[model samples]
Target chain A: MKHFSLRKLFLGCGALALFILAWKLVTDAKLVSPIFFPGPERTYAALVKGLSGGAMLSQTLETVQRMLLGWLLASFVGVFLGVLIGVSRRARAFIAPTLELLRPLPASAMIPIAIAFLGFSDNMVLVVIAFGALWPMLLATIHGFAAMEPRLYEVSALLGLSRAQVIWKLALPSAMPMILASLRLGLTISLILAVVGEMLASRQGLGQSILAASRSFRSPDLFAGIVILGAIGLVGSRLLSFAERRLLRWQAVSR
Target chain B: MVVTQLSTRPRHGEGNSTPASGEARIRIFDVTLSYGSLQIIGGISLDIAPGETICVIGPSGCGKTTLLRMLAGLARPTSGSVELDGSVLGGPNRSVAIVFQDYGKALLPWRTAAGNVSLALEARGCPGAERLAITREMLEKIGLGRHADKYPAEMSGGMQQRLQIARCLAQEPKVLLMDEPFGALDAMTRQALQDEVLGLVATTGATMVFVTHDLEEAIYLGDRIICLQPNPGRVGRIVDVRLARPRNQLLTRENPEFLRLRRELYDLIKDDHQ
Candidate 1:
């Protein structure tokens, strides 16, 4: 297993090196105009310049802040409502149809409506990001709650657990694996919507910076911005997975 | 030893020889359970004395589990009443704890063996400072002292079952209901757990209602074996197991009385299935 993972690591690095080499070859051979497609060297130079200037740092932070805020709010509401609807038949019957209908509509599509209602503001962008992230978290939570075995309920009930105790001790923990999975998915969606919202309707974020760079034909800066966005996604995913590993250590051990 | 013939009608307060041995710890009075138009448990009545270990044996769909659930107040009887110490069992009573057959599902997978046992103490509002000590004690009692840190999934089937039993015991219950808890274990593990349970109950003196389809197991563990017939399950027979206490797995199985009781239970079940 150790040797296999080492081989996998070598392969991954080789794949990345090959991709950069291909990009360098294309740019050096002028397969595409440097005006449209910047080489890896030029992109890296632009990225360094942006970092030193602090403009890219602020923009990246802005986008990340929006994503985190929206994602957190969505999680809070989604889990709360999901559990409520999951456990109560009446609540599900009353609320599920509306959520189901709303779930399929893309979060980006709501940008126009959000702009109309809230104008071009941070709140507008945040609302859109939250809206986009909500469905996955809500649906996952509901599924988690619904999938709970009846026997757990029986065990808790026989133990004379109060309603609050049952939910806290059994329901929440039992649904955690599913809940965490949804949060991972939601985090990605939140980031996507955060950038999309900035590109469409906001002024101060990585999305706006990227859009601005592209409009001015700064291909290197555009490439640099894209790379930064990818890095942000990578970091966010890694952080969440770290948290998942810590929180679900028992799940891993059991497996 | 007295054996009661299967009675289709409710025969509340009729089987126990010692009527004055206080009130029945758990009294099922003409209880019937149904879902919609389909009856699952037909009129069934029985009484379990305090500290008695009653094993329920029957074929599939016999409502043995349902009866156990009713006794635990997890399910309400469709008609008639189930009483715990003379009060109608309205809902789950704190004094009752259940050991379900599917230990994998019954135990909280997210908790360690000790954490799972702690759940009961926590629910019962055992003081925070005392939970760890009690958890360790219970885990030790179930022979899982070394495995207290292991998750239910990390443990083998028998270990998980022991963890479940430990959790149940931590409830400090007056009544322990086991629903085919050893059904998934191997023969050796099953016998070991049987003896462990017998020993635990001997010390605890808790009223036990164990449900199983295994005739020999029922005979070995029970003070009285209640056999139920299926198709809206009802009491079919109540056999008194006169086998000696502190039963030896090898010696008890070899005892003539144990063999006779096993034979009798097997014939009774065979006739019911046919």
Candidate 2:
């Protein structure tokens, strides 16, 4: 146990150390010019400048606000639709062909269509993220429910459980692990869509900041913005994983 | 210790103490089950009194488990009907419970031992206090009070099976149908659980219809043993175990009559596979 814990600690430290080393190397080597791959110091300078100026801070706030809205909306809708499709064979049969057809099309691919129909609005971005992430969540629900033992169903029936009670008590709890896995995948996809949606068709948020910097050839700011994006993605995924652990502690203890 | 002659009289308890309108505790009338055109068990008729322990022993694919399932309301016979105290058995009746052989798949991994038992009660609409009380009582009965907080994966195979039993018993059902509940356990654990089950059954006064392939297990625990032959399963013979109440597994296995009866059952059904 001691060795295992130590190894985990070492790996975590190793990752952070690697990130600092890579940043130092690029700055020291003058790799790809400071204009393109700015040093960590220059990136920090840009972050300070962006924060001091309320304009950039508001954009940052707007970006996070939009991400939260889109993420929450997509998660709720995806899980609802997923449970519906998973439980009902008729729904599955009806939607299977259509889902197969639409699932492969990239969320980014629909940006132009979204813009055309709903015009560069928050609603359009939300729709794209929901559409993209729904597949994984839906597939997880179907698989998790299908994998449940018939014996559990028999037990439920023998107890005279109502259909709703059966679904909430037995079906949902059993499918939780897979559902959480799907949520993780959905979260990742949502982040990608948020950035892509803002980049393609938006007047606010981090994506626009990157685009503005790129257009002006202010490479330091662009690199700094990209760094922040990566940070958000990393931290967001970690938060999700932490929540999953808390929710599935029973499952972990069993193992 | 032969208590009484094997009653060859057809199971007719119409005028018994149980109210005339009330159904037989377990009534299987000419139960013939099949999968498509191939019938598995034909014309199976048996009536189990309340709290009686009946062990069905037969060769593989002799529809012993099928009969148990029929009693548990998991399956319907192709030709005849199964009734629990007069009500028709369709789907799962609230009063009947089953403990399966594959405890691995039977218990949900996400639930704790108490949670697993409590789930059945919850589904049965038992109030929170009542559910908790019954869950606690049953877990204590099975000697799993300490492990109530543990999940199935943390428990040993025997513990898991005991949890299954506790879960079934918590419902306080009138009839308990078990299909090879201990068939998967090691010999030592199986024997221990056999005694545990005998004690539990006597205390609960729940009619038990257990299916097993082991002749010794059947002869040891069963008040009456029904040996079945395969290839369109049918009841081959019935052995009345005259052993006294609260059977001792080790002592009973050593009994001359027990050995003879066990051998007789095996000999009768030995040709089933061929």
**Maximum-TM-score candidate:** 1
Give candidate 2's TM-score.
0.91
Model 1, position B104: C-alpha lDDT score: 88
DockQ (C-alpha based) per candidate is: 0.77, 0.60
- Name the candidate that leads on lDDT: 1
What is candidate 1's lDDT per residue for B1-274, written digit by digit as tens?
1123333544333333332266799888888887776677888878789999999998888888889889888888889998888889898888888898899888998888988999898888899889999999999999999999888889999999999999999999999999999999999999999999999999999999999988999999999988887776878878899988989999999999998998888898999878
lDDT over C-alpha atoms for residue B267 of model 2: 74
Worst 10 residues of 2 chain B by lDDT: B11-20
Model 2 Cα lDDT, one tens digit per residue, B1-274: 1112222322222212222133458877777876765667767776666677889987777778888888887888887788777777887876888898999788878888999999888876789998888898889999999998898989989999999999888878888888898988999999999999999989888888889888888888897888776556677777788887778867778889988886777777776555
Minimal lDDT window, size 10, model 2 chain A = A54-63
Q: Is the docking of candidate 1 incorrect, acceptable, medium or high quality?
A: medium
lDDT per residue as tens, model 1, A194-230: 8999999855999999999999999998999999989
- Please identify model 2 stretches exceeding 4 Å from their true place: A1-6, A19-31, A52-56, B1-23
- Reference-based lDDT, each prediction: 0.88, 0.80
